[model samples]
Target: MTTITKDNITDSLLATVHPNGNSEAAQVIRENGFPTTKHEEYKFTNITKRIESKIQSFQQAKPLGLTQQDVSKAMIKDLDADVVVFNNGQFSAELSSLGEGYAVTNVTNSEAPFSIKDLYDDSYLALNKASFEKGVFIQIPKNKVLDKPVLLLNLVKANDGQLITPKLWIDCAENTEAVFIEQTVSQDEQAYLLNGSVEIKTASNSHIHYYRVQNQNNEALEVNNLLTDIHRDSTFTSFVLSLEGDMIRNNVTLNLLDSGCEGNMYGLYLLGGKTHVDNHTNVDHTKPHSESNELYKGVLADTSRGVFNGKIFVREDAQKTNAFQQNNNILLSDEATINTKPQLEIWADDVKCSHGCTTGQLDEEALFYLQARGIDKKQGKALLLYAFAGDVLEHLKIEAFKEYCIDLVQKKLGTNF
Candidate 1:
């Protein structure tokens, strides 16, 4: 039995994980210890239990190895995009596509200028900093615009349990515009634990579109964290789509440091078969004249569960701020459950902030009306669910991607249209 106690993890890291030398991050993880459900931020998710369940399986998994063909089936078909592939937590330059106006390099060769101080009060981030074996740094220079989107494909090939950590640091320079899509997949019906983190900074006047697409097999579990900082006149937009997974949690934090900044967050989760998904988001407005918008919707079937916690904060000095948040969920089965909480804190007298949350079963009246119009009951239900999620899909600027999401939703509902 491979147990992850304080002494055992510390000894293992010192001996094998970081034989070159134990980093400060490892020490921090050891000191703070692993988190439990007692932690308020993770109240609905039991991370410790999840980790323990896979410790032995991870130890017996196949070694890290993958080929392009193993991942080709999961890729977006016929999409013209710059691709960056990571096989079992390690970057694969041979399978990636690089373009001009940006640089992508390994963290080790690029000095890995990440400081533990940057990740304040987040133990998982500290642990990632200490344990990650492979990381990538993406830089886009000033006044540059990427004509095509960049796709980051992370393929997990472990049949048994495996611990995979992939970190990304992206810096968008002044007056630049770019788009990044991150996709997660499994080579087969594998079981694994993924602790992933991405840190993003947007310079003044920069615009970025970030997409997180999770389509893993039912056996995988993941904890993903995203931290972002936006400067004056910058815009940051995030779209998260969680289609399938056994247990998945997303923690996103955005800080607007200067005036005239904007942030938008949109997420859609479709879960079934005892699947669990949780999303926690925080938008902080520290300066005057900042705006933020957030909306997340989910569909739950069978015994699946969904959770959404979104908070928006306006500092005392942040006058002229506007913030809005909304979370909605629909349950298709009697056993399905959803928990949603939308919060707003405004210390500024001249700021506008509001939040709302809704969770309920499908509208019976609407279903009846659709069935009356020559549509079968099952197809009618699927149509209504599609309409509920269409708003979020329409927000996607990429036409091909939007259609792809639509297809996935239809397939999940056992319908074709």
Candidate 2:
């Protein structure tokens, strides 16, 4: 079944009415159907089913217990940059401290968000825009180098049957260098679902680094949408790691508007105990001399399942374009399953593009080689899995964060290391 969701829903959502400040965006959601896993291109991860098809009413969510005195206490170790915290889709001003160089404000108060007004037309974005009572607007000044990363912390709360949605936007000015991090977590094993979106824009000659971590409650379900627009001579890199949530679906799209731009995307996911995680990526090369690369890997244990779909498109005038994509999966148990696909659509003959995917069980020969040497079967498998993930972990540049992710993967696989 594409979705095993609630067959009978009361549909308590507002009808042609206002929620917070967005009457126009709310009207769009009331007209178009809420995004459900039944929607094509979103079949594998059933987010709607996770929520049992009910829109939740908000109640001042506090996912990250942030306090006014957090500056002197409860600060994330080694994090010395601007930070914004959101609990249950509402922005926290005091818990979120802006850096000296950057300005963080409310979308209603800043022109930073309106700069990307085109996004308001998007059905999902419009839904969030209408319902979101509070959101963050971050602006990076031109010709500035914010050496430290800006962190956005999003926390989710599970109600046996509830639906929550959040919206976040990040913008980088011309000739600027910046990094953005988004982290999410949930409290308990109660069943719930989150639908969210993130938009990023980079001006000419600018550089941006984007990273996301999903650690929702064990019983939570998450559906995330990411959209990025790149201008001439800009560079962008994206990373995603998932270890929590019973089912997770991530949809990411990149648009390259001019020449001399480069984009790179990497993702790592670990699943166990009937968990499901799906990652879909699309790279659009609209002009010449643009390059893009993508690599995604997943490890599934017990009855867990995973899916990966990568698509690259090159317009007729997109000559001298270079694109590459690879998806690999390792199933540590017989019951595990994975669906992988790599696709390329190129109209320019002068372009260089390639794609491939692989799925298989652990190498029997290597497993026995180690088992024969007195290593237990479980330990041997963990060692091989760790080696497989080492390459992806190395691509993570943040030292402490990298180490934490490594430990997280190990813990997911029941390996202490």
Candidate 3:
């Protein structure tokens, strides 16, 4: 049995959406191929091995047209929101709705606001950039506040091994307020890989709320990258929830390019079985009087593994910056594992920065106290774990999603919420 290697990545690239001569993404794939155990960032998660096992499946998957019936299975229940559906990385107009003050179009119709050259350094991101066949561009009109959220759902209908690359560009105009929820689901149990990316540019005085949920089947592999540019006096908040997957990785980057910008990142991972989830986040403060906050929590059961590496960088010009980050986790079984690293780099003389991380099991004393109050041992443990993750859950402003997460946690713990 032969496995995938750097030498074969270029050959594999030819089977998909291969671009012509000297494309940056193609070049990056050739120079820096699949990562190995030696790569510092990928040491905890061996993506190369996972890809090798599912490489054939990805090559066999292809896009198919979707109908309303197929979209029905993935919609957010009871949520009054404008819905957009992407089937195998292609936008489906029959399943999408553009509300007032909103426009959704194909990227080919307009110029890309950001250059892909800047992102070519990252191999996975470059791969998506160079191979993505269909993408959507979204715009929110200036000063238009939406009464309902916009739901962006990515559904995988492939019955074989497949590769999916979806690209999104969102522009929030000045003084506009909007909320976006991105969710992924697959009806198929076959092995597949999803490489997705999002680019958001916000104008001054706008507020944007974004949420991402990965709930694919255990046979799927998903890697997602999100890049957000926050302008002066703007706020961008992102929340990520990872429920189930064979392997999942999320890379979120927030750049505060102007003064008086605020960026917030929050995430929760509930894992069981042999699942693996890794979150890598970077917040860059390039201007003065800016602030960023991040918190990620996880619950690992069975032999599951979770990893978090968060970095905050404050440049010399970013004086008067305040950055804080914290990561907390709970191990439900002795075999469960967690590797966390919270880092801060401050080059400014007048900035306040701090980072903290803790990984441990449920507090026995607290659990005992709850048990002494007539609560069963099972319920007590569940309550305690929920309380530990309550802080991050409170940050969610959407009631529908909050309720859904609560139900998921309750079901996973086999206790009532």
Candidate 4:
């Protein structure tokens, strides 16, 4: 038996059962425990404390069933994609519309196509591996190009304090191309903790694009972990757009294992009220002739806080590697704060790597220029912020989804794009 008594958070999850009845993850959790402010990775954000204060137990008060009408209301309008819906932490086969190009199976019933490496260090990942009841596994076969993207929609309707863990595994075979969009929405005003994880494997000569949109209620707390392994002659791109939530943390890791692999990461966060958003990314280049680019931007207003930490590592044998990382933030209110750290560690003498960060208020000169052009202060500020965020949004390949994201950004900024 595994014993996890470090804190109430771990103790509350005692009732969760692993699918295979394996206690390895529980044992790991018992050893490593949850991260605290003292941990270097969590120095800026005290997420464990926040989660402890918000959730006392992982028990559900009632079950909020979903209907087809509810799924329709939460969907992105005019977005042409196959939909896969999960109510709470379970997959809803009746509500999902999976295409024929890919195969979908429950992780509990099928063995994962690829095994995840290094499970002893992160307690959160171990927790998910131990407690997740049902996870979705998606596999795209070789030489298949989907006509449209696949949408994975997670709908949470927790009336009382609850813990919801959702996991996803994606495997892209050789010479395949696919796009995946993940969106999470909270339907109620109650407190809940959502701990989610996604693992992706990209084979050689494959292209995979992933988009994550987080827009939840103020009472919702979320933690998301994403890991991707890129093989030779492959490209992996990801974009994360965080618009709402009380406290949200994102951990993204990319491993370029072979030569000619390219990885790109882009993010934009707009926060207000007492919301807090943190994004941590790590890119490891272990092979030569690989490149990566990362850029993350934020707009903080009211008392909201934001944090960004990005690191790029080029091993000694990874010669001729090219990596770049940048983080920029704009503070809209006196109380708004941002902590950003961009780092690069290159052991290869021939590698080119650089990292930089900027934290400041909106460009006053640009705002004033817009104002002089007959625009009001609010509208001018909105225009400037939209322009600042457009850099990341323009990279969206899907036109309808791009427009939908633009509209959401406009609404959040109190203006029309």
Winning candidate number (lDDT): 4
Q: Write the per-residue lDDT of candidate 2 for residues 320-381, one digit (tens) a residue.
A: 99999999888878888898878899899999999998888778899899999999988888
Residue range 1-417, candidate 1, lDDT tens digits: 144653354343223233332366667666766567897777887765665664443332223566667667667876678888887766789878778779998875126644323424555666566567658999999999999888888877665436677878899999999988899878778677777888899999999999988889888888888889999999999999998888898988889999999999999999888889999998999999999999999999889889898888899999999999999988888998888888888889998888998888888999999989899988888888988987988778776677777788788775422
- Assess each prediction's global lDDT (C-alpha) against the native: 0.80, 0.73, 0.82, 0.84
TM-score for model 2? 0.87
What tens digits encode model 4's per-residue C-alpha lDDT throughout 1-417?
222233555656645645563377677777766789888888888877887777656652233578989889989999999998888866788899889978988776234445565412666766777777678889899998988999999989776537788889999999999989999878888878788889999999999999999999998888888999999999999999999889999998999999999999999999998999999898999999999999999999999999998989899989999999999898989999999989888899998888998888888999899889999999888888998888999888888899999999988987411
TM-score versus the correct structure, for each prediction: 0.92, 0.87, 0.94, 0.94
Error of 2 at 163 (Å): 3.8
Best-matching candidate per TM-score: 4
lDDT tens string, model 3, 132-212? 766788888898898889999887865543778888999999998988999888877777778888989899999999998
Ranking 2 against 3 by lDDT, winner: 3
The better-scoring model by lDDT among 1 and 2 is 1
lDDT of candidate 4 at residue 326, scale 0 to 100: 92
Q: lDDT for model 3, on a 0 to 1 scale?
A: 0.82
Model 1 / residue 155 / CA error / Å: 1.1
Model 4 weakest lDDT span, ten residues long: 1-10
